[model samples]
Target: MKQARSFDELRALSGNWLSREALPAWIENGYDQRLELFHERLSFSAQPLSDLPRRLMVQCRQLYVLAQLTCRGMRDDRALIAQTWESVKRYFYRPALSHRWAFSIDPDGDVADPRCDTYTLAFLLFTLAWLYRVQPNQDYLDRVDEVLTLLDGPLAASSHGLIDAVPRPDGFLRQNPHMHLLEAFLELHESTGRADYLDRACALHALFSSRMLWRAQEALPELHDDDWQPARPDDNWYEPGHHFEWVWLLRRLSKATGIDVDQDVRLLLSRAIAEGIDAEGFAIERVGIHNQSAWNSRRLWGTCEYLKACAAEAEAAPSESEAWRSRANSALAAIHDHFLQTAYHGLWNDRLDADGSRLSADVPASSLYHLVLAIMECERVFGRVVPPSRPEPGRMRALFLDRDGVINVDTGYPRKPADITFVEGAMEAIQQAQTYGYRVVVVSNQSAIARAYATEAEVMQLHSWMAKQLEAQGAVVDAWYHCPFHHEAQNPVYLHPDHFDRKPNPGMILRAAQDLNIDLTRSQMIGDNPSDVEAARRAGVSGHLFTGGNLALFAREVLMPRPISEASK
Candidate 1:
């Protein structure tokens, strides 16, 4: 397969078929045909509960695949996006609220297990950040900040790495969660420009590059003790997905930092491809570094992530990027051919023999999402580009958002929609930005929710109301992220932990960047408070702090053509 020069060429090549439409070609044409190959074989032996984290992680990956898929075709499917977002949020937020049920049922909160896994938390943070992009909710922003603060308090180490990757109560360590943490932080850093967030991202990048990547074997050490010393190198015991996944992250870091990461990406990706690739064009599931034959069944997620990594490499080093991209495309082509059957178009957890023969199949929804994201990324970067439905001029947007005094009447910790009031010209300012193709993102903080002054539900309702009201005025927010945790509050929810997402923290602004896919280095943040200025500074957003002046006037003045007219030239 040749690399696509444009998205149009990509569309023509793929024949514009959705993965579902393309799956039958995989079944009738490809190899692997075992009935029970993809799904885990049900045996008489009782399944271990400890495997929950791994299972959950897989589920999260699949959800990502679905999101990518659903998001691809719809330019106006707001309802579909909202529903899918709620489904993913159910996994994260439901568990978060589980504590309340424990307190109610036992009256003493004696359930012992909090259902909080480090892997779960890390995954949750990633999802939350993603959700904010699609939905642009402030409550999600607060939740992300809240969750990370909790993790830092319990999982962070003075030695500059997260504690051995364990969920609550055990205090153990693991590589998967740390890797996820690095991924989530990198996302957060890109969304907002807080040095601390970037610093954390760099620190984790260093930790993984220097400490996790096996120097001699050019592989990742699966298990680590509390101090991060490798407990084992046996690949069978760990999934191969992480290695491929890390390749993508490393490449993303390299791209964001403008640093030469070809060597690192090549080192990791080449090893994965060499060890995992098969004659069938699909990579093997698990392979021992030295054993040469301890491979597990090639699974859907491993292949999808490997392709994702390849795509990332393609993006990072375009010159030689095609080699990896070709391998990934081949792997995905093989997967679609062999794994998918006529009954289902999604992924199957079919077990494959070492020779790439399928033994069984269980189409898991979780694996579906990663493939969706991988394909989506490929499409966005290389797929055909039709003229947009609406033609608009791009603007260097300095989102002149009116906080409390400008958009809504500043009710301290506004608890309800009834309390909301829009300032004059606020809607117009938002309209102006949209007209010019400047993304409109709201960067605000509501410490009142953390202060026990308001409930989470109410805070959510308030945001919902705000969005609805804004939309009513023909203004849409591309993204909105807020910090609810305040330093001082009566309620535990309100009690402020010095979090990075807060106004001064730069979290909300950063989140906007990630969600809107805006170039923060070229964007501006307009707010009313010193904290807002600081938030802009933290997020690397360039803008002016506003006061009781007219935002439209400010925008007009700021947007006026420079004295050096093109006519003069």
Candidate 2:
């Protein structure tokens, strides 16, 4: 397969492959008619028709995939997702156990494993969160609250932050469940905007950093003792896949909670790529503390995790973004060549031997969730689709201006509000833009905060003062965005070499589009720097250079329609 040269190409290729080819094949071959849900496995010769005990994790995972598809503009799956949810409610949820979900259910609709598993519960919450996002229902929210209550009460172990697998000490502990718990909390917070969910997620992140992650070796041990320590310190086992997974999760957490985990994320990705990946670009399953191969087999899901880690690293490290993007493309190529070479379109080899022979004969439905997530990350990083809480559809235009030179004089490091002075005719330009039905906004790069020359509070104060000054002249400034990041920043907290929100990254502009409901294609950005223009280009918007002189004249000339030849001239 040919490699993708740009993010747009990558997004188009990935999205189309999933939506047009892979997903349809899954729906056609993965569904079990008698069970009224997805089949556990589909062998090349025959489909399993027997009603066997299926894990609740599988059911929830399938439901989550269908719900995500529906949320992403595939409206045809809504009915199917709803029906699957009904099956989950009927078979998986045990009303006798305080409405706790069973671990697995038999063919006769009996609870095969009545034990309440923390990992299974996390997936249930995650599915419910996505279902609630697609179709807002009070019932789902109530169930979420009830599940949280049970998890905190009856299922809670003596350990402060740990939940039991079977409401008793089975001498088992794993960080996998906590990882999914964090994912669920973040999804809940996204759908509901609940501070409590964010608080819970923060706690899980703390657990990961302190207990789960072995900082000395830069590894995340899979098995843990009851006290949350590694089961065997001398011969510890780690999965490169888990490290890759944590890399992406930590980046998400840092963005959501304002925590700085860049150093840790970098370390994890670097080590995972260096030691976990084979020479053939496949991600191996398990390794020891000394980087010895424990399980030499490569799994499909492991490759997916490696791809996602590369995507996340690309976004975080701009200087090396191309290298990371290339790595992602290489992983994708490996998946296509080794896993998807079967006669069936969507049927992928789940595992491969060390020499690259297929180990599994049947296709499992659980792997779809992993592939979908990796594709979704590609879509998000490439700006193919807006975020889940997208702006309402409209044709509203906006005028984005840079503050330092466009709005005010380019006085370097203006810390005090008293030193602020508006450029000539800048106030008139703002009023005129509003008169022409355009939202006026300011987007600036403030490395001063990173350099410790000014505090964020001081910058906000200056913006407020500037807004007040504009209000006196019957003008308005709709919103303000600034980046306080620099690679060589003096302040440790603000030093980010590849900060996504910095100029030339387009994060602030994209965020403004989401928050203000601005039509980026119709909007225009005015700045004095080339980086500003590049940022607008990346955001899929038009950018204009402001080379001084009357701001009102520049605004009028740009906003007004002119003849093609005259305008070009």
Candidate 3:
């Protein structure tokens, strides 16, 4: 079917729904203030399903959603995320069961399901990673060590993907939990600069490449045998949503570890796009790969996964970026038309039948994990639909680089593509900074706008192009801050004497720190000018004067150093 709305419009609608409607609804009703835990589901009217049993997986997912929002400055739920962390420990965590958390708990906070579910545990770990990223707490770090130790030991192991059920009914080896575990490990690595998490994530990627991937069918097996082979006739199915999810994860892992998994990513994405998505832009819930195509309805979370994969694919396959982007747009439309159209308030329709009917009466809280991350990926690709949040503390640290001499040679206000010349190892330095858990923020002084040589819009356009170029090279400049006003401005509108944002004043650096919640104590600024150093000093950040040579080496040797934890030990 044709796309119901343009990408910008579609994303705007989603963003508005999130900021205006869903956020308040979920925070007010979906979270139990008295109990200090998130509700398992919301009624059709957006009220909490207060009596329902709460799953540990759902609790962790909701907390993760809030943590994502906290990181984005969408909401400062750091206090709530931490408060509920304790609740999770009290309600679900079983210290008696070798410190394994229970699967589900009732409304009264009694254990509903005592199994040490691998899926729930992965989310728990995932939540911890995100929480720690928002604010580095030693407690969260220690907990991560505890969880990893438990997993690496004999208790958390399973034939496939760890143990979903404690009793291990028929020893069902599901691939889904393993996928989440990989995600958790990757995030853990990024959050803490821990090598073991990266190594563990690599191990999971190898598992996917070797056993879980159904190369003959170019698909992933929903269930695998104990021997790591696809479980046949009885389990015979493929979740197309999962194929798309794996595409995103595989590319991410490849970027992090420099592992060559793009081939597998291509294979999985190609098959999923070819057979999984219907003509209506709906991602089929399950494809009966054994010649039995029995799909009853689709899920909103599936389309969310589709959007995420499309974003990743668009980046990886530049030759076909247009097609992948088009698919992503279509996925958003599918989500808007099919799911977000519900008049009542199950955040968005969780499930829809083939004839476009809502299958469920309440919204599952667990889907927030899929939707929040999916929407963020969409924003990253299609540009942010929401407004830029104000700067505040309690955010992550950053590595702020001055643009002119550091990112590109200062050829006196270079505005055009040809005028740009990247400093040595600029890209590698950015990649390294990100790998070591720092947001790469680019702070620059663009006096060209004030001089009337280039318009503000033109300068911004160039910056956008520069950012895209850097991203294409696997070096992401997370945020950009530029001061366009100058005291000697030829244009009266741009004439501002001693503008706060100008480098020597520390305005740009300070604004960026506040906007992104960059911790100045941990952040460092790299630049070639004395003004850059002064600005860094005023902002309470360390400054490094780079006269010449490799920025990558400077970043590694001076900024990063051996301080990054070798968690492998």
Candidate 4:
């Protein structure tokens, strides 16, 4: 096994200017074009960006849709979300007069091609399903129904039950489309609680594992010909992004079905890091058999996806999955030091080398949300403190909670410092957790960063004042993680997509986990929103959905269930 690299090694090789030179290009160029295609109003074309072909285009859209859905779920960004949804309808939906103006015909419609490929349809449906869940619009639901109807019509899957590319007579089912469809169907299943969606998702999962995944080689086959055979193993090497997507889905499926695909999952995940990842945690887009320049390619989206995967695996398998946890942390740190800029407070596009010596400098528009979600997931897995609801037997890691609405007063996205008010028992609940001897950590998601209503630094100032007030009452927060990304707001540095440091994205929790070396699975998380609960779940943490209680009372009820201290073996 390759040992993880140290920070010193990274610094020595890249020199000091690596981040300065490479970050700007990555930020300006990476994921934005795709974001503009899906979310922003484009004066350019009705079709989606043509730079990538149809298959990759659909995959990119699906990835973006997933990111947007997660963002909407975490925070309340309804107005701009609605505007973006309208554009999605115009571009991807049917029954409109422009429906006849297919992308393949004149290259002037929503997607680049007038002809709707099976991959395109699947991802489009997936996006529609997520939008429906968030906004609950009848129009969006109806559109989803219509698309499903057409999907049943022309784009039938092969006997293997995999959706076939409509125009192609090939049996080749690509992993990218199948993965999104699985996610889309899983979302539908969750929203509607239908067995059919779950069943379909399961079948797609099986198809991907049996056919698309190469077990012997421990890698994923990127492309295939008409037959379900590998067209080019060397050419088919993919980055860790797709691998991580699969890992997350597989873990979720394992929990849902009580069946484990862990062995296959590990093989694919390890191969991704070992093969695709270079020494300094830079995930190369493409790699050749030997160190050949012909396949020397790199991109930013790949790195973003890899981090998400790492965060996901860390949550799902942190205990027995040391390799995954360590590498994931290493990759995240690399991204932070290299791609993340102090100037923009967001990630750069891509890197020039494995050591992250050359910053690609441009940030891809699509990468903003992807990076945000990644961090949230990471924090969810890593951040949490024990509450007073459960009494600790001994000295334990106590979860320090900020006593706003989190412990009590639900002011609903407190905009002003004047709006700061305490909920009853909030302080007592935290004190209870502390009384039980748990090491306390505080995790909170603040959207004011996006609103430009306040700076994160200012929020910190308010939090510091609040902490003093809490300490006066015998409730002390040990450490705090506050997220400041607001897509709608107008801040130069704090606005837009960010890394894992944000809540609802687990950067803060994960950082706490690393800094404190707390056993996350044994840890506890308490937050006001379902996002907090999800973050806890993502972190493999036991979490409580709380409101209006004494911190001690809640702690006694919640944290007492599990033993606070584990015997060191």
What's each prediction's TM-score? Answer: 0.55, 0.68, 0.73, 0.58
Clashes of 3: 2
CA lDDT of each prediction against the hidden true structure: 0.55, 0.76, 0.77, 0.55
Model 1, total clashes: 34
C-alpha-based local distance difference test score of model 4: 0.55
Name the 10 consecutive residues with the lowest summed lDDT in model 3.
384-393
CA lDDT, candidate 2, residue 275 = 80
For candidate 2, lDDT tens digit of each residue in 105-157? 78777889888788888998998898887678999989999878867876665
How do the residues 4-115 of candidate 3 rate in per-residue lDDT, one tens digit apiece? 4446546645655665567788888889987799888887788788999888888878888887776554556878887998998898877877656788888999988887
Better of 3 and 4 by TM-score: 3
Segments of candidate 2 deviating more than 4 angstroms:
1-13, 167-169, 383-569
Candidate number with the higher TM-score (1 or 3) = 3
Off by over 4 Å in 4: 1-76, 91-112, 161-164, 169-172, 225-227, 232-238, 287-296, 321-325, 340-347, 350-364, 385-569
User: Which candidate has the highest TM-score of all?
Assistant: 3
Question: Per-residue alpha-carbon lDDT of model 4 for 286-335, expressed as tens digits?
Answer: 64422322233445566666766765676565454456556666766666
Query: Which residues of candidate 1, in runs, are more than 4 Å off?
Result: 1-77, 80-113, 157-160, 163-172, 191-195, 233-240, 347-350, 384-569
Query: Candidate 1 residues 1-569, lDDT tens each?
Result: 53323222232223223342433322232211221011111111212122112233443443343333333321223553455445334332345453211111111212333354666666656655555544557886777777767567765765556663333345345677778787777765654444565676677778877776666676676656566555655542334667778887876766556556566666676567667767766666665665666465677667777767766766555676558557656756655555543353323445567665666533333444555555655543333111112122222354635367656767676788778877666777778776765777776676665666765446655665777787788977654445555667565423434654566766556544433456666666677788777767766776676675566666555444556775388
RMSD per prediction, one decimal?
A: 18.6, 13.5, 9.2, 12.5
